[model samples]
Each structure stands twice: as C-alpha cells, then as structure tokens.
Target: MKLLSFRVKKSHLLLVGILLVAANLRAPFTSLAPLLDAIRLDFSLSAVQAGLIQTLPLLAFALFSPLAGSIAVKYGIERVIFAALLLIAAGIGYRSYGGLFGVYGGTVLIGLGIAMGNVLLPSLLKRDFPQRVASMTGLYALIMGVGAALGSAAVVPLSQLSALGWNGALFAMLLFPLLAMAIWFPQLSHGAARLAIAGEPQQRSGSVWRAALAWQVTLFLGLNSLIYYVVVAWLPSILRYQGFSAEQAGSLHGVLQLATAVPGLFTGHLLARMKDQRAIAVTVSLLAAAGLLGLLALPAFATLWVVLFGIGAGSTIILGLAFIGLRSGTPAQAAALSGMAQCVGYLLAVGGPPGVGLLYDATHSWHGPLLICAALALVMALVGYLAGRDRCLTPAEPLNEGRLSEEER
Candidate 1:
C-alpha cells in the first residue's frame, strides 16, 4: 500500500517541479567555472580572490543550510522553495552586471537560495515519495548534472556573441530559476498540506548530530563535495595549463558533467537492491582516484580521465543522497540528517577550491594540487566505507540500529 501510494501518477507535476528545482541548484555555480579566468582578468583579481568567489556558495551552504529546515518548518517548504527560486533569480540577474560587489553579493544570494533547496529537497522527496527515495533522488540528481553541463557548455558560446558577452551569458541563466519558480508556484497553494507532508512530528528528533552513523554520512558527503567542487572550480584552469583552449576546456568540463548523469539512470535501482553499499563506494573512490592520477601523469588522455572522474563522482553523489534516505527512519529524520550532513559537510567543503588554488600558487604547478585531490579521494573512500554500512539512524536515537534494519530497508 505504501509503495502504491508512492507510485501514484497525480504527483507527476510535483516531481517535475522537484527536478526543475534541482536543475537550478548547480547551473548558477557551474556557469561561472568556464569563465573564471575571464572574470579574473576583467576584475584584476588575484588567484585567491577567484577561488574565494568559487568558495562563496559552499560557505553559504554551510551557514544557511541548517536554517533552511527551520524556516521551512515555520513558513512551509513550498513557500520557502518559492522564495528560494526568487532569490536565485534576483541574484543571477544582479550578478550579470560587472563589478566586485555584484559578483560577491549576487553569489551570496544564489548560494543562500541553493542552500535552502539543498536541505529541503531531500526531505521533500523522503516525505512524499517514501518508497521511491532512491529513484527520485537519482532523477533529480540526473537533472542537476544536465543543468550543470548545459551551463558550463553554453556559457562559452554565449559569451562569444557580440551582444551577450559574459554578462549577458550569465544573465541568461536566470531563465532556469525563473522557469522553476513558475512550475513551483502552484505548490504554494497547498502550503499547509506540504508542511504536513514534508516532515513528521515524532521524527523531529535532534539526535542525528550525535549519531556515529550520521557523522560518517556527513564526512562522506563533505569529502565528496570537496573533491567535486575543486574539480568544478579548477578543472578548466588545469586543462588550460595543459594546453587546451578556453572553449575546449569548457567543452571538456561539460563532457565531465554529462558523464555524471549516466550513473543516475540505474544507480537508484542498484542501491535499492544492495544489502550494503560499501563495494559501490569503494569502486567509485578508486575510479576517481585513478582518474586524478591519469590527469597528473597523462594529460594527453584528458578526456578519458575526465570521464572516469565524472562517473565516480556522479555515482557517489547518488549514493550520498540515497544514504540520507536509506539511513533514516522517517521523513523528519531525513530532513534533520540532510541538514546536519550538508551543513557540516559543506563547511568542510568550503576549503576545496581555495585550498587547491593556494597549493597551486605556492608550488607553481598542478602537481601539488592534483596530488592533494588524490589524497582526499582516498580519505573519501574510507569515509564512504563507514557511511555505506547497512545501518539505520532511528528517530531520536543516537546509535545506529542494525544491518539492513527493517526501519531503513
């Protein structure tokens, strides 16, 4: 019966809205990656400042994510989502204008908007699509990858147009959040129902922060974010140093993101059937690590390396998101876990881009930075092993219950 409820067709529109929201989450950030050098030159910014711009969103995610659920609880998730979309739209629009203030300020807004969506979307999925958490997460995650690809790919071409330039190219991204807002508006009509559907009173326990399992999940997520964002922020620069043109680098970055979407197609079902995800976790970790090693040793085969990294990173993302659902006993627990993981996880992630840039600046080569990433990938694998254990975070409970626990599976 619960499964059938999750399969109902009436909620299709809501699912579209959810995917659309996911789409907006990454486009605003990834669009800037391809143009980082251009923005840096135009603003006369230092390497550290450029990295700081890239780090702003992660910082926002860390600072604002915990508050998103509380705000949703008070204002309703749908209303909060509506506001977040507006915030993204406004931020992107303002950011299109050239200046340091416009850049940093708009980024802050975009980051804050995305942070709320980040914390709320998983909770929304768990609450409304309890039986379909993995599949639904995969679907949204796939859309996110697509949006990222489109953003990274299009920005280069769009900037070439005489009328658009980088500013217009950036302003063009506002279409996503604006379109998401249009689709999301109807959800606000059922605010009370959405509030009830998105969280449960009994599961609203504060115990997730203390659970060892939860910390493992949080570290897994944080390490993944650190690796992924470092790649996003600096991959183009690394490729450029390897002799790829800006357009070619951007195109390759797009390919990397497109590669990420592939695993989302089947990983959900795979995760659903697995008793424990440790094997899957280890495989992705090794794949990404190998890719990093390839980039450092054989820049000639950059495409292959990028694709491998993308697959591992993308698949791990689906697993990380699925863990939030798989490890929790209820929707509210999922929300709390999401908030806890993302807040602490993203806080740790804030160091990735800037750290890489700093390392590069100090050593004057990509070797040191790439080596650092490779090391982190190994750490990520260890964290993934812990997070992948078949256990459940019982509501209001500080300890993990059991392997393939009934409450979780």
Candidate 2:
C-alpha cells in the first residue's frame, strides 16, 4: 500500500513538472521581439541585422534538432531538459549585460536550450501519457503558447520597472526555469530507475526514414512554422507602419500569440473525434491567407485581420502537431518523425523572417514580402491536404483508415 501510494505521488509530481517545463519552452523565444526596436537603436543595428537577431533562435532550433534525439537517447530526456533549462537561465542572465558578441553568444545558448526542450517534450509526453497522447500534446502546446504570450506581453512593463531596465526584462525569464529546475530536481534523482524500467537499450527503426508520409508531414510542419515565425518576428513592424503606436503594435502581436493558445487547448479533442483533418487544415490555411491579404489590402483594419490570422495560424499549429503523433505508427516513430520534421522544417523556416526583412529592405515596401508569404500559405494548404489523409506514415498502410484510403492506394 505504501509503495502504491508513493507511485501515485510520483506520478502526480511528474505531471506537474512536465507542465512547468512545457510552460518555459517558448517564453525566451518570443519575449525579445517587443524590445527589438529598443535593442536595435541601442546597438545601432539595421532592420536586416535586427531581423537576423530574431532569426537566430529559429536557426539554432533547426541546426541542433537533429542531434537532440541522439542526446536524449544517451542522457535521458529528463536530464537533458533540466540541463537545458539551466542553460536557458544562464543565457538569459548573461545577455542582460553583454555587448554585441555576448548578446549573440547568449542568444545562441538560449536557442540551443530551447531546441533540446522542443525536440524532447513531445517524446516525453508520449512516454508519460501514451493513452492520452493527443490530449496531453494539446495541453502542452497550450501552455507553451501561454508562456509565449506572457513573455511578449511582459517585456515592456518589465523594462520600465524602476530598477529593471532592458537587462531586468531579459533576466526576468530566468525565474521560470529556476522554478522549473526546483520542481524537476526530484525526477532527476530517479532517472536511472526510470530508464531501467523503460529499458536503456536503444532500438533504431528503419521504416521511419523510408516513409513518404513522413516527408509530407515534415513539409507541412515546416511551411506552417515559416509562416508563424515570419509573423511573430515582423508583425509588430508591419503594424507600426500602419500608424499604430508602438505599444499598440506590440499588443497586437501579443494578441496573435495569445490567440494561438485557444486552438492548442481544443486541437487534440478535435483530432481525436475527426479522422480526416484535411478539410479543417484547408479551411485554416485559407483563413490565414485571408488574414494576410486583409492586412495588406486593408491596413486600417489591422486588428480584425490580426485576430483572424492568429486563429487560423494557431489552429494550423495544433493540427500540424497532431500529425506528429497521428501519422506515426508508434511512439518511437513519432519521436523520430518529430526530430526529422523539426530539424528539416525549421531549417526551412529559419529563412522566412530574415528573408522577408531583406525583401522589405530592398523593395522598400511590404507588398512583395506579404505576397511571398501568401504563396507559402497556399503551399502549406496543398501539403497539409496530402498529409492530413488518415493513414499511418509507414508505406505499408493504405489510405482507407480515415479519408482517401482507396484513392491513395
């Protein structure tokens, strides 16, 4: 009875720790945008250079993601996550005082930390909540979205506090990881025992690499991420040009981020209920396209379009994540697919924002860049359709499980 009770307690503790870890994943990435202009001015950076700064983390995520699986396999997910959080805290704290080199160095560290966390979390969710993978993934995404919104919303206020300054704003991020570390420490102590139960031996599956559905899912994920990050990095600037105050522009950006959380909360439930997620994906992509067009054609109504874009983008994000689990034949496949998707997709995505900024700088107008994004959205829709068909990523599975099964065969 005592042992059973202890097991229950450990499970509860583990859940809480996972939630906290999820909450910390996105804050560091999104929080810096609100302060970008201020930092740019202080450092005398051009728009392109500033955009590159914002692009660094995405680049890090892309570059480091492929290695995350190998690292997690050897070190254990919990240890890597905990260590990553500490690195994030250190990076955030260090950047508070550094010069340009220090800032970039620290940002790279933060990005690497986030990359490890991002690649591992879904696998962790799969391991911990295998029966409720979709639901737990939705919750995880929701918390991450909330964390991002909070980080973006808090930067200005944090910087304004009497003694805080910009450094204070950056340092504020350290608190979340520190708290998460405290909560996660106990789990690390039992890491070896858990590994033993789960088996420490690594088994590589050959099917994941040969799958066509895997590439489709990865492309869809990448395209969606490109669109999302482009907006996150530049939407405020776009709004600023539309004659809104800096604060209002930042608020709009924050609203878009906040809206992402809503779909995340419901996506798992929706995926579980409906096998064919293609129609939903197509509709959401159209909404995202409309929102972007709305911003371009009707800048005066930025708020409405931003909201539309947010909902559309947010929903698509949830759907893309759902594919990570739904399309994979097993948990290990899911993790492998996730690692492949994020690595390749994010590397593709890393170009979106900086590319947009460079185009904007050269063309001296937002129209060209906006149009390019719209085209990308169309591609996202097409790929999403191909990916959304109800079939496992393994080639042996036919399309008939959910939708277009007969046609696919």
Candidate 3:
C-alpha cells in the first residue's frame, strides 16, 4: 500500500530528499561564518563590504521568499528543489574559488536555493506524510541545526589542510549538494505530477500586516533574528579581538549553532506545560542580553558567555516559530502571519550584519557593537512580552474551540 514507484516506499525517497535539503538550509551560511574575516582580508573588503557578504543571503532570502511558494506551486516542488540544490552547489563552488563577482553572486544563488528549500519543505512534509508531520518537521529542524553546527565547526579545520585553503574548504561542501541532487534525482520525473499538492487561493479575511498583535509578533521575531545573526556573522571576529585564536573562536561558533539545535529536544515538553509563553519569551531575551553583557564585562569567561548567548539565540529562534502558531486564530491567519513574519523578520536580519559592521568600522572597537546588541536584546524582551500575550492575531475564532478556518471548506 505504501509502495512508490519501482519498489520504493514512495515516502522513503521523498523523506530522504527532504531531510537532505533540510540539512542544507543553514549549512552554507554557517560554514562561511567563521571564515568571514579570511574572506574580508583576502579581498581587502571594507568592514561594511564584508558585512554585505553575510547580509546578501538574508536580503536575497527576504526578497525571494514571497515568490518561492507561488513558484513551487506552478513549477512543482520537486523540480524547484532540484534546481535549488544545483544553485547551492554552484554557489559554494563559485564562492570558494572565484573573484568578487563569484563571491557575491554565489551567495545570492545560495540564498535563493535555501529560500525555496526553507519555504517549501514543510509543506511537502505535510502533504506527503500528514500523519507524521510533527515528527518529520522536528527531524527536519534537527537536521538543519546539526548540519549548521557541523559546517561551522568543520570549515576552519578543513581550511587548514594544505593545498585546500578557505576557498577549497568552501568548495568541498559541493559534495553534499551534489550527493543530495543524486539522491533526489531519481524522483524528479515521478514526483512533480504524482505528489503535487492541490492549490488554494491566497486568503486574507483581514491582512495580518495590519493587525497589532501581528506587529508585536513580527517585531519579536525580527529583533531576535537580528541579534542571532549578528552573533552568527561576527562572533568569531568578536572573540578573536578578545585574544582567542582562530581555532578557539571557530569552535565556539560551532558551539553556538549546536546549542541552538538543543532546544528542539526540550521545546515540545516545555511548550506543552506552559499556559502562555510570555515568561518564556522574557527569560530567553534576558538570557541573550546577559550573555552579550557578559561578553563585554567578563571577557575571561568567553566560553560561558558564548554558550549563554547560543542558548538564548537558539531559544528565540524557536520562540519565533511558536509565536506564529500560538498567536494565529485561524489557519488562514496563520498562513498570512507566517508569510508576513518571515518576510519582515528576515528583512530585519538583512540589516544587522552590515549595521554592526558599520559600527565596528566607525568605532574600531567591539564594545559599542556589543553594547548596542545588548540593548536591542532588552528591546526584544519588551516585544516578546507583548507578542506573547494570550491573544489571537485576530478573533477569527478561539484557538482552543477547534473551529475550522475562515476559508471555504
């Protein structure tokens, strides 16, 4: 009954491909994070220019996000994903070996590829394996986290290998996407038609863009991301300035991502027990602030500080996702809120790297940037409280009432 084509269990191949793509979602960026200064130094990139390297992918993700879902609808998810893998591979290869054009161009492609994968994979999971959506989605998230951690950790070591410098290390990642493409290629012809999800018209009874609760959730998600990515893009350099060696800083960067993935293990249990998540939100945001301040005030304990920051950053990432579901009253509202939050949230993240870079460039000191993000972390705490209030995006229906969506059923 579960037979797919040619003795394949249909879902098995699909699951493999989906998981492969999930692992790739954050790997490309995390791999490059610790190597950012190397890239900057090699190209003589100004601080702001180096920041753009980090920002470009986020910018591209934001700009392309709204369109990816629709594009997948028309062309088919499998085909889009197939192409996305290709882009990611090409991006990595180009970014590693080529000149400036290759650098920025490659990042854009990676972003586009990641955007499609991030946007569509969950829907694909729901469509193909509705019964296992929750578990599959959790696995998907875990894979992304672990993949990112590995990428962050592995790059410096790989780059240190003779005849395979930073660019070579980046290029080595091509093997993953290439392998994924091979794993996924077998289904390219069979899937687009057989697994196609039926399309639905975009529904907006009231635009989530206009809702106050929507803005609160949006700001919370946005600010948290801004702080998180600032850390991702700059933590290594920040630590290095404090006299940690490249290897040590790189290891800690990996730790940050690994810690992020840890939250998934406990998130389900914690959320189930909480009546509302306001306290949770404030706690995480404060954790982030404390860690940031610790970085400045307690430089000797950088390891503890980074772990705290990592936990706080990781928690906020989950909180952002949870708020999307917790605050929406209807499925349609959730859909709209999701689109709005992600688009706006990533847009906010797009500015964080370069903005911090600009500060660093101006002041020639890390203290100002660290202090600024710490202050923003406090702001995230305030927004988290408002966003976490026990309220719906709109009173479309009551969340616990188990009402159907506003769209025609």
Candidate 4:
C-alpha cells in the first residue's frame, strides 16, 4: 500500500510536469504569427522571406527531432528537457531583443529546444503512465492548447494596445517558457532515458523506421502538421485579405487556438473508451475540411469556420501523439518512432507556409492554398484509418509489456 501510494504521488507529479512542458510547445510560435507583418515591415522582407521565419522552426524540428532520443539516452530525459527549455527561453529573449540575425537564429534555437520535448514527452508518458496513454495525451493537448490560445490572443493586444511593441511583446511572452524551464530544473535528478527489456527483445530503431505502422502514423501526423502550421503562419494574413481588421484577425486566430483546446478535454475520454480511433480521426479531418471549405465559400462565418478547423486540428494532434505511445511496444521504440515521425512529419510541413506564400505571390489569392489544405484533410481521413489500428509495434508483443499486466500478455 505504501509503495502504491508513492507511485500514485509520483504519477501526479509527472502529470503536472508533462502538462507544464506541453504548454510551452506551441504558444511561442503562435505568439509571433500575428506579429509577422510587423516584423516584415520592420525588416523590409518579402512575403517569401517573412514566411521563412515560420518555416525555420519546422525545419529545425525536422532536423533536430530525430536526435532527441539519443541525446536523452545519454543525458537523461529530465536533463535534456531542462536544456531544451533553456534554449527556448534564451531563443525567445534573443529573437525578441535582437535584430534580423537574432530573429532567425533565435527562432532556430527555439525550434531545437521544442523538438526535444516533443519527441520525448510521448515516450515519457508511455514509460510512466502506461495504463492511461490516451487520457494523458488528451490532457497534454489541453494544456498545450491553452498556452497557445493565450499567446495568440494576448500578443497582438500587448504589441498594439500596450507599451510593448512587437519586440517587447515577444520578449514578455518568454515568461511561460522561462517558468517551464524552472519547473523542469528539478527533474534532472530523474536520470536519462533508458530502454526496458520487454518480453520479446525491443525492436531496434531501424525496425521502427521500417515499420508500416510508423510510416502511417508519420503521414497522419505530418499531414495534420501541414494543415496546422500553414494555418498558423497565414491565418492572420488570410483574415486580413478577407477584409477583417488586424485586431479582429488576431483575435480570431486566438479563438481558433482556443477552440483547439476544447477537444483536448474530451479526446482522452473518447480514445480511452473507443475500440479504435478511426471514427474520431476521420471526423476530425472532415471537420477541418468543412471548416476550410467554409472559409473559401463563406467568409462571413469566419469564427465558426476557424472553430471547426481548430477542433479538427486539435483532436488530430492528440490522436497523432497518442499513436506514438499506443503503437510502440516499449518507451525506447516510442522515442525512436517519435523521432522518425516528427522528423519526416515536420519535413512534410516545412514547405507549406512558403509554398502558400509563393502561391499568393503568383495569384494574389488565399483561396487556392486553403482549397489544397481541404483536399489534404480528406487524405488524413484515410491515413487516420490506418494509424488508428489496435495493433502494437511488435505484432506478438502484448500491449501491456511496459506495465507487465499478465492478462494482456
């Protein structure tokens, strides 16, 4: 009984820690999207060049995510996450306070920091909260969504309505990540990420890279990322093009991000109870499609459309992250799968903002790019079906290998 109590207390502590880490993930990036035009005007950059600011992080994610697992193995998950948060804090300050070089370089550093956390968080959950992966993932998404909502909603007002200009607004936005960094500091003593010897030997990194399930989850996550980051980068501009005020546009972007948080509260309940995730996964994509289609067809209902997209984007994100845990047999495989998926997933997303920018440059229209995203949402429906399977990484390994539940084995 005493041991069980201690384990429960530790679980709660880890839950708090993981959620705190999740909050810093997207807020930093979304906070800047509303300010992209301001930065562009200040820097004298073209649309394509300005778009690179958004692309740089995704590029960093693709390049650095694969390395996070190995780094964690060497240094420990807690230590690596601490360092990642430091990079995030430092990057936020530098980007906000410095000039053009600081802008690009700081964003890159922030990306690298975030990439480590992103890859490790699911693996951490898989290792620690083996019984409730889906539920915990939902909570993770919920907190992350709230943080992003605050960033998107507040930054424009801070920059426009307060004493803080764009730089000050961004600089001030560093507080959340700084606090998260501080919170993570104590976790260093937990030791580095290590592999467990499950019933069957854990599949190596190459097995994960070669697995069809991993690839499916990768595409599911990648396409969803493509949809999300594109909207994050261009939604403000898209709203402006549709004749909304800058403040209105920024507020709606916040609304969209806030809407994203709503599904996180329930996604866990659904994923936990449902036999498979195909239904929710497919519905989520269609919701995004309908929302984007509404954007093209009906500009007057922008709020509703944004909400739909947000919910879809948010639920799919939760599912994708859940898949990383759900599909892997061991935490090590989880990290390997996460690294590979995010690397390619982000690579698939890295081109979106710039491609949309160039498309807009060519046609002076947001319609084309939005339509393309809507079509991809359909593709996500199919990918969701495959990724939502009830299988594990090792076909014969019981789903309870980490927890070692005999019934499951």
Residue-wise C-alpha lDDT for candidate 1, range 1-409, written one tens digit per residue:
8877865644877988999999998999879877888889889999879877887888899999877877777778889988999999989987889477889999999999999888888888887788888888888898898898788779999999999888899999998998898888878988887676565553444677778788888888888888987897789999999899999897888788788889888888888788688999888988888889999999999999999999998898898988898888776677788888899888877877777888888888998888888888898899889889877886644554323457555
What lDDT would each prediction earn against the true structure?
A: 0.84, 0.78, 0.76, 0.84
Q: Encode model 2's per-residue lDDT on 103-125: one tens digit a residue.
A: 78788889899888877777676
How well is each residue in 137-209 modelled by candidate 3, as lDDT tens digits? 5566777888877787788999999889889889877877887898899768864564334223234423566
Q: Candidate 4, residue 390: CA error in Å?
A: 0.4
- TM-score result, candidate 3: 0.78
Residue-level lDDT of model 4, residues 219-336, one tens digit each, is 9999999899889778999999999999999788878877888999899878988757888888998999999999989989999999999999989999999999998877777888
Candidate 1: give the clashing pairs. none
Ten-residue segment with the worst summed lDDT in candidate 4?
192-201
Structural similarity to truth (TM-score) of each candidate: 0.87, 0.88, 0.78, 0.87
Candidate 2 vs candidate 3, lDDT winner = 2
Clashes counted in candidate 1 amount to 0
* Model 2 regions more than 4 Å off: 1-5, 41-49, 194-209, 240-248, 395-408
